[model samples]
Target: MKSAFIILLAALPFAAAAQTTQAELLRRGELTGTRPSARSQARQTAPRPANTASDPVQQHLLQTDVNLAQASADQLPSLYERFIATTRDERRQWTYPQWDAAGQVLARLNQRYEQVRTTLPLEERLRVRSFQGEFHTLRGARQVKDKLD
Candidate 1:
């Protein structure tokens, strides 16, 4: 049981990366570069959010300046589906701000999942767990991609 659990946990990030790698986001952007626009650049340069959050999850969200907390308990499955759809098939023509905005929406979706985790149906919760990991993985990958190039 322990080994199986360990293997599943180890593969989660890989699975997430497989769905949407950092390189993929950069390659799909129209500007041919990962540079932020003037407005996003200003937001990035602005003073960081306060670090007073006791929860690690809240702290991470603050650090990214992308709050994607979802408010609707009944919307998790559909929202995740929409996210997956947008990212997979429709975002190829997007620019930097669109990418950034998508990232923010992704963040909110994850937060909404967190908000309703306990209240969700078993199948919905399970489905969201998969999406939540993918979003975090994508966010981490994108943040690294931005920093590197």
Candidate 2:
């Protein structure tokens, strides 16, 4: 009975540290006491705020940005659609500076979207994500095209 008790006590540490390796265990210190916090484990850093209206380059201020800023939660999808259509149709003619301007405008619009995202329907949220993905793809393609040229 004493031998079994000793075996279990020894096994307890191994069980608790099944995921960790020898090097990690040595570096992180003894896991016998308190575990390290999630905050100390390097969570994703927050994004820095963009300078929209105050941008030094004086970005292309689309009328959609004004409308989107004033829009209610339910109106966002339609406003996004308007912005997407305008950008999609116009992007073929854009230079690097124009693309940069469009990106700044999109960033400003995204800030507005974040404010009311939770209030939107699941379908609208998915649609917005889809729009964002498409815009990123379009922007990447433009960069590639520029590099080729």
Best by lDDT: 2
Given candidate 1, what's the lDDT at residue 130? 71
TM agreement with the true structure for every prediction? 0.41, 0.56
Mind giving the per-residue lDDT tens digits that candidate 2 earns over 82-118? 6577778888988878766766566556656666788
Please report how far candidate 2 places residue 65 from its true position, in Å: 7.4
Off by over 4 Å in 1: 1-71, 135-149
* lDDT on C-alpha atoms for all candidate structures: 0.52, 0.58
> Model 2, which residues run further than 4 Å from truth?
1-67
